[model samples]
Target: MQRPPRPSAPRRRMPSPGTGLTPLLLAALAFAITALLTLGAYNSARHVAQANLQNTFEYRSRDAHLALVRRMAVYEEVLRGVQGYLRGSVNISRKEFADYFSVLRLDESFPGIEALGIASIIPPGQLERHEQAVRREGYASYTVHPPGPRPVYTSVTHIEPFNGRNLRAFGFDMFSEPVRRAAMEAARDTGQAAVTGKVVLVQESGWDNKPGVLMYLPVYRAGLPAQTVEQRRAAIFGWVYSPFRMNDLMRGLLGEHSGEVELRIYDGAQPGAEDLLYLSPGTAPGRRPMFQRTDVIEMRGRPWTVVFSSTPALEAQRDTVRPLVIGLTGIGVGFLLGVVVWLLASERGRALKLAEKMTLELRQSYIRIEAEQRRMRVILQNAYDAFVASDAKGRITDWNIKATQLFGWTEREALGRPISDLLVPPDQRERHVRGFRRFANCGSGPVMSAPTEVTAQRNDGSLVQVEVAVAALPTPDGYGASAFVRDITPRKEAEERERQRQQRLDETREALQRAQKLEAVGKLTGGVAHDFNNLLHIISANVQLVLRSPNKQQQRLQSILDAVERGSKLSAQLLAFARRQPLHPQVVDTARLIERMDSLLHRAAGEGVELRHTVQPGLWNTLVDPNQLENVLLNLVINARDAIEGRGSITIALSNADLDGDALPDPEMAPGQYVLATVSDTGRGMAPEVMERAFEPFFTTKPEGKGTGLGLSMAHGFVKQSGGHIQLASEVGRGTTVSIYLPRCLREIAEGVMTPGR
Candidate 1:
């Protein structure tokens, strides 16, 4: 500690010369720079707000146009259906036409189409007869209006619902008006639906005369070819047309009012009263909108101009800004600048002490920065992934220890080598070189600041999958790039395996649903078959007894007996499909059984099919009913014979298979050894839809009265009841295969073996 000095007396000093003017001058300079910055910020904010408001207006315009076009398309479909009926029918009757329209319920279901009507194209001479023909259909006073002699006359002959609104247009001549005639002629010549321009419809009364349009679809004669304009006119029979009011259609589509935007629609390019079809409430002559845009939409070969404008309420909501924030920010910044200027000029001695303190602080900052660099070096050396640094030319400048371990290259060997040549695959080396040049020239690349998946080559010439992220480092000359790479081979393989497992699960679920449905149908069929079989048994016994008592062969009695025998056979087939037939099961070798049936199978297959059997030695034995097994084989063999059109081969293969818990052939089969029996035919196979229902009883592709559709169904039921699974695969025009997997038996072949025919 040191001793304290004596206090000195305070001295008063006068202001220096010109010091008062200096403060005023400094304050004026600060205000000028602050004002310039504040004005620039305000202008930029206003411009940005205006651009955002313009985009909002344009988006709304497109949405309104799409809504109008989509609604008009729905109305076109209604006209096409009516046109099709007229062309298809030979003669149109009054009752038939009325019944068709009554089912449509046009007024209740479709609000836009006011009424549907038919207009006849009549000659001047036959006009009287047409009127009489209409009167006979209960319309007494019908006549073609605009009565005059012309080359052709189109008069409304029939209109549906027979109401006051539709009756008003019963005799109006559509050919007299130019606007309606243009649409009709287009429909006849082009064979398509056409819409007319703006006009007051004939259906309107005194105050309801709104702007409306008509849609016409032409109907040609039944047997004529209307390929040209001249031929189409000669073959024209009539027209199916409908009328629509603009106000009613717009109301149903966009409601009574659009809250945020005003709309105007015009018939064509011009925007005058004659061409203007519609205008919203606030879009009248004198109202000026804040933001507006125009779009043109095409409907049925006619262009409609649509203009969308933002209302005052919408503009105010979108463009509003906070004035208080701007004012406060400007004031705060000005005050801070004034304080800084005053401190600099008035406290020169204090400034000197501050400079000395700043020098000492700078020295401490250098020590802290050096310590941070050391920490970063430690992080790079101990990181799990490789971190490499390269120059603008892609020469490796720095390599971490992880890089050496990953690529099997020493740091000494990796330094000063081109990055592409050292790590990138040979096929991708040229592409990497081109990308590096572009990055150096433009200071940007697609791979910068993002992770990318790529293949990299190691020193041993093996490729590895890696995920790389690159960052640009600012250098004294230009810029350098640094990359961090991580191996991702294991992750990719895991993702692929998971995808395969999910696919198998989906297939299993679909198969299970089909099996459940078929099982329910089989149960129902079995109950019905059991009851019918009892009735047939009683009938056959009585018929035989009656014939014996008569002691004569009556033809009718013989027919009755034959019918009973057929019914019993059908019942047995149903029982087989349901797996309810009586069975005595025993272990048997599939190879020996097939050898016994070799000759019979050839006879059943016919000369067109070449049958062959390939049986594996030491095949596992399966426990099944011998009689049922023989029946199943006969059904399968006959089915294959029918499938072949001319000449083909049918092969039977027998083998042994094993099923695991994770890899099961079918969801219903247990994990164990199985005996597989497959019957394959090279013939015109079934389509996908046919193959899906191939196992259902009474479902078949064969013609009626030629064969019963219970062959495959019976085989499916028998195999499932015998603790086995069945699978079928077929492609049209290629072939068909039916595979049966039965549970294997471990018992020795020592019991009595049943012959194939028995």
Candidate 2:
């Protein structure tokens, strides 16, 4: 019975599932990831915004600096113009200076310029006359006195009558004032612009008590030494000085943005001193300086400082960004939590098992989606074409990096703006919108293919040409459109340049063709003229012998002789035209040659046309066939006269010119000095077709009876044979210019006397 009781019962214990740590671990991880992401995003956004702000400030600062420099350049230009007028040997007077000053006043850019005046170290006698003029004008307040070894007088201040006030301190010695003295001495030493530190003027009887800085630019005579102490070169024309009120200069420089920013301009040489240019009201009057002593010398020599501080409004703007970031972060966390909770609660056991098996796959899918989105964004940003997408209503939905670069606008600034606003000029906006709409519906238009040339408007209101391509994308509710725009101005310009180059090449080829044809004609004409000359000589001898015979009739013989003499003259003309006649070559001074030929050339040109000679005085002597050259001149004049069709001008210019290897028509030609003779005519120019055959024999524009058409052919042959080259340039409705270059004679010719013929 006791053993049976011992085995009575083994108490049954309930099985228990372990407390869930997996869910807790997942929640904790989610929190950690959310916190890390928020912090990283906050830092990245802050850095980007800060960088944008700094870039804007730097751009504005540079603009202000350049504006000041440009203003100074303008002043220098005005002064240079005045100096030019003075150097023209014209008398410099008060009236002339006043007129120049009036011009300066009329310039809107120089708004705050106070005065512009000229001063000079006066000679002893001129000083008295200046003083007398001032006294006679009833300007008792004006005073003049001698200064240094050379007496100098300051003119009566021009501001006196305008301000209705008289200041009698005109005789004040400018050399005694330390600021003015330093500026003057620097000008004398450097022969450049010299500036002085701020100083208060004791002679400011009419002007308010405002300290100013002085600038001086030196003026020296053309031949005088720039810097010297000797009496002969001691004439230091008093400095052309201008005084700028420190406060006014600083205020004007600040412009419309004065309240939005703080500025400080410091003299780097003197640090921790009261020479501050400007300080905003926000800055304490006596607070510790933001800049250290070392910072002052950083910009020494050309010492300047520009301190920029953001306004309270900008600070508030920065402060507002923080709450927005926090709000966005909270929204993100809630969305993530909702997604996880939904997955956990709806299908606890089944989802957990499936998630465990497919975790890696799901993660890979998410990573791929993210990478694709990033790739798309990068492609849009870096593409050279300006990509823009718009909604159905023509409101901009997206803009790419190239759009920003081309239009000077950022994505943030351009988004949600009207697509037509940027792409259409004011005059064509309606038409452009209609065209865009048509393309959207039809899927084809002028700009639908590869990018075609069009103009786009920039943020700064500048127009630039672009090649544009467009596509319409179908959407569930409406249509979206994208445009690809590429800048094509440079390409268009290059194409135009190529077209012009081709045109010039064509013109040159035609000219060469004409010249070749002329050479062939000249050769033919020369042969014919040589034969004709021999025949004419034989006939002349026979006629002379018949005239001396006893059986000859006197009247008949006279008539025959006359006819023979006329025939002889005609033969001579033919020889000249063919360039086959004997020539006497000589070293002729071109200047004298032109002067001597002026009358004859004018006579040949006739009364309707003007013949002018612009022969340079020192024209180099050229060795050429003078008789042939003269014939060449005559032929050119005749051609020019015919081209004129009655009334025009013919200009003959003779000058010395250098022809280098690079300038030669071909490698066979040598480089050296040459005497250039140019014959230019303002006439009814020949067309391209006519010019192409102008030099050919028997290709004359004249009537058959008027000309043999051997003029230019002969001219070209003669010039080439005399060791020279000729070029012809012409344009329809413009004129023609023929240039001949004869090699300069560098050596003296041996003199030879001509003996009597046997």
Candidate 3:
């Protein structure tokens, strides 16, 4: 039995080559390699596309910025020419000044200038000959009109002094007007040119319609000799004053589309703060100022405010390109990867067949790989994003298409260069490298899967947002890592925009809800007021009838009549609060209205508060019921006093505004003009929540007896009924500004004709 067992030992196991488990292992390895290569190729292509797009954007932005700067420089040159004549750096006779202005008008670019004039500060005696010449030549007419309450020096131009247009202005004296005097003082004090705030200036002596702002530049004796700083400057002999129409000036600087941009010029000479020299053609939308200041550095002591603007055009352009690049890169990489895998598989079985077939298959695979590589290179060359690869020791092994595109480096230039030297943000490099090492050791267990957003340095020394996904690769000797990065700047911006939109929606919803609630309260108050009026009338009538009776009953009836009369007055007030009574709207001067109600408002505000009225001179008249206006004033003062809780100040101001089509906040308004009545209070201000509900009927913050809450609601309804708008602005601690804008009358006053009664 033991001898027979020896025969079984001779049966040996056959070795299987390239079959079963071995083939399975080889296939799995090939799949893994193919997957890694495909991913790498795709990422490389993506990097290339992103980099190219970003470069194009940067180049375009720079070009636009430079163009704007050059345009502004041209504007400065034109301004300097005017400045030269004003400062007497260039001697310009009246004829010469007029000629210069005419030439400037011909250019058509400086449309902001309404008219140009030279006013001599030296008294009539000093410049009598010049004035006589002006009159004799018919360039300007000087008339000593009948002496009235105020001395009016009227200068009329038969022919436009500068451009020969028939423009005339009357009743203006160089020495008069506070704003003009201040401008002259500034010119002398600073020994340079000066500009004034929004002012009304006469354009053409006899013409009463044309008005504009004045820019005055002083003229000094050019050859004056001196030793000290003061001695070198000549005395203020005269000034070159230009009538720059506020709207026209803005239009000229911003072109015809001034509505798209906001322009503000700030004068630094004003002591308290910057004075607004100019506001563009239209006021800013959304009730908020768009741009703060666009300053012109003083060229020889003349500070000019050039153009300050907030435009959405540039920002929108910057945000549209990043995603496009990413998409293109992804498509290219996927296509190339499929080709590479197909070629590798096609070559696999041919290695042991015919030698020619093996060689041919190898060549085909090489050709396919090269083509894919070339495609990847082309994509990277065009991309705007930065792409980099590092070896196990953190040395830069590969810098693909996007890396060169974004960082301004080529593969030849960046290969073998330490990635830390160019790609790492200075402050984040150390931390990033540490994290990278951890990821490399752990196969992305800790930080690799985390979608980290970080800033990477570009070739131009700018930082860009990069969304990175990192993974580690293990080889025979060591480990390395690859980062898949996508430029996320546009995405971040999109998210921010969406957030703001949502916020605005929420705010709008809240405002609408508050408005609806207020409307409901108004209906209730109106019903109560109507019923109360009927009751008051009945009681009064019955009391009157009883008073007609004889004896002791008559005396009692008289007492009842007195009580009924008081009750009737109270009902009238309640009706007014409910805005249910008919209003007789007529042209009423807001200044006069405020003056008439001052005493009542003061009394209503009590001893702890001070009531002040700032009525603008030459205030525009508004069409509204005089009684209702007074009631509005009273209600506002009373509310303001209550808001203060004890002591504070209340100010009422009246002003005029030109509301153009682009200036309206609501789309329902028609363009033209308006008059503004403003009431401001220095009190514990209302929060956004409170202010939103302040106009709601019956929504009171005070105890039941203290407020009717219908006051503001009634005011809002009355204003709306009168074809006007009411806006309220308040902060938690910064008090409140309530403005009422009423349409302005289109009536024009005839020259030299007084009103029937005046």
Candidate 4:
């Protein structure tokens, strides 16, 4: 069912493009912010790189300064070594001084040192004595050099390896120079080692001159008090010193080539070019330096200003591309973010429009659903069959009046009650519950396979059979069921009556057919008996006539006995086949019958044949004519005896048997529990052709007049009429077995065996 369409709502206009914070404006803002942040990052990275470069430069410069200081200290130690040598002997000769200086091995042990010399502190009056004292050692020209007068003259008295450039400093007065004098004075006052400022050595004369420095250590008299400056000055014997070229000394510390940073050392506190004692090779001309720093280090008593700067190689090592990468990334991210925001806003507008359209459709759908529900309610209340609805948990949710009337319960009472508990039989409750559970858990189809029959209980505790058509009703919560139920008990009863009627008809037809078969057998045996009657009549007439003669009386009487026996057997076969023979059925134990007949059975089997009677214990009793059964057994024994001819064994076995219609050897026989009696012979067995006609009257495998062939025929007919079966099985070499199955009697056995009339 459907309802009328809902009224349409007025459409609202959408905002035009370039509305507040358009994509372009937003993009511009994003870019500006990102650019600002990127610039800040770039500045931060630059400052960090600068600081790092300066720190690296300072570390390298300080290392270089330490190397220089350490080298100077080693040279100072060399002078102290010389001073110690003199301390052992106060009056050392010039030859002794020369020997000691040569032993110092200045050239090999202390590389980069130009020379080692001893400076004697000569007073103004003792200058000539100092010179004469040094000239007497071998230098004829030895005299206090820089001959101008001074407050105190310190003269280089002894210079080792006094040849070559070192010969120039053999009598040089170091105290005459201000820088040299200052170092010597400091050594004397402090009684420690000292170094002079950058100076031109007196030995420098060639064009390849390098700036040089001197290290001095004061020597004092052995017993003088040298603790104070005055005492040190008064006790001063001389000074021991070594000179070093700045170029060679720096080379020993920094290697032959410049490194990542450039090094510049100034002799004094001022880093002025005039005072620059050493300058490393400048950086590549085109690439300017990036970082520079100045540091001061004490050179013994003086301070040297050391300047360090980044070279081209050092600048090349810095990471300068990070800032560019960050800037580019920021620009790309800003653009993408703006595009994303634009698309999101556009989609938001489209979503709003779509939602409005959907709202209209939804309202219309709700109206249609309400109309459909009204229609459903009308159909449900007035439905022909009982209608019931249940939830997923098998509890009733809806019940129409028809359902209430059918179940004898009102809707109010049925609602909220489990469907099984409300209407289902106790025996069927679990099964219905399982079906409903399958519906709920697996979302299966109908709970009862649709249009199924179920036995149900009414509200008054009465049972009713109902035909139920079930269907699954799917709701948002889960699965529920809708069912139409109708009473089927009357229909089921009529069907049962029809079935019983049909069964009765079938049984009657079968009985009629069995009667017909018996009639056919009776007809055949009667005709044959008629013909045999004529033959027996002739034989009887001849016997009666022969009885007149006394000579052949015994032969005629024997002939009469044979003829009468043949007639009696034939009549018996005809009576049994026609089902006209009288039968006295009683509960008889087969085992007991076999026991009573044992002697008789052996006698009938004759002396040449061995007769065996075997019976199982607990065998079931059978209802049959015991005399007829005894006759049947006797006939089987006689036949076995005849088949054996001279010597053989015959076995009669009795056992319990159970059979169904299919298992019965005779298809016409009924199925039930039975007592089986089997007679087996170890003799010439009948061939298939003979066995087929073995139950036919006047049919025989014996020589002429040997057998009437009515033995098995009578047994088969009588067994059939007594509601039992007869079976014959034989093989050419394995002999034959005839099994007779009699219906088992369900009542008590008779007390005594009856034969004949009884």
Q: Per-residue lDDT tens digits of candidate 2, residues 1-758?
A: 45555555878975555447666777677767767665665565566556544544544455455545545544454443343334312235556556555544422444434445454544555655655665677766545533544433434233211221123234444555666676667655654456665565433554576555555555554334332334213645555655555555555554554554455555445533566644555654544432211223221013555455555443333433643454365346556555345424633654465456346544554564465445455556655467788876677887888788888889998899887786677777898788767655644454432234667788888889876545455455456677667788888899999999999999999998898768866865674565456556656665776768757656556766665775665555456545575667777766766666777888889999999888777667888767667778888998888889768999999988886654675465579888889999998877888877666544577885677666776777677767788778899888899999899998554466221111
> Model 4 misses residue 629 by how many Å?
99
| Alpha carbon lDDT at 598, candidate 2 | 73
For residues 194-292, what per-residue lDDT tens digits would candidate 4 score against the true structure? 889989988887777778888887777655455467877787878888887877777646432257668778998877867878777554545457777
For model 3, how does the per-residue alpha-carbon lDDT over 1-758 read when each residue is reduced to its tens digit?
A: 45554444566878776556886687677666656665665565445444433443333333323333433333333443354434333334556666555655423544455555555543343234545655676646564222333432322222125434324342135545677767766765554446665465555455443334565655444334322336423444555555665555544332222344455555454322245655544454555422233345442333545444544432232323433433343344335455655434533433244346435644654564475455444433443334456776677766766666556778887777767777888888888678666655644433332335778888888998876544354545456655545678889899999999999999999998898768776766675676467656766776666667555666656666766775665555556545666787767766766666667777888898888878667877677776777777778888888888666888888888887554686687777678888889988888888887787655678886787566887788778777888899998777888898888765544356322211
In candidate 4, which residue ranges exceed 4 Å CA deviation? 1-37, 88-111, 122-136, 148-153, 255-257, 271-273, 283-289, 334-758
TM-score-sorted candidate list, best first: 1, 4, 2, 3
Instruction: Tell me the TM-score of each prediction against the true structure.
Output: 0.40, 0.37, 0.31, 0.38
Candidate 1 lDDT tens digits, 1-758: 88799798888888899889987777676656556654654465466456656655564555566557756765665565465445322258767778777766666546677788888787657777778877887779888888777777878877886687778888889988899998899988876678888888888896967888888877776555565778777777778888888877776444322566787788876667678777775555777888887877776767778888887766775533522233344445456455334434423553465457545544554454465445445556665568788888888987889898888888899999999989989999999998888776655565542356789999998999987656565466556777777778888999888889888988998898898787857854674565456656666766777767776547547756776777776667777777886667888888888888888899999998999999888898889887788888878888998999999999989999987764586676789999999999998998998988798777778886666677888889889889888999899998899999988989867757564464
| CA RMSD (A), model 3 | 35.9
Candidate 3: stretches off by over 4 Å = 1-580, 606-608, 660-671, 732-734, 748-758
Clashing pairs in 2: none
Query: What are the lDDT figures for the candidates, one per model?
Result: 0.74, 0.60, 0.58, 0.74
Query: Which pairs clash in the backbone of model 4?
Result: none
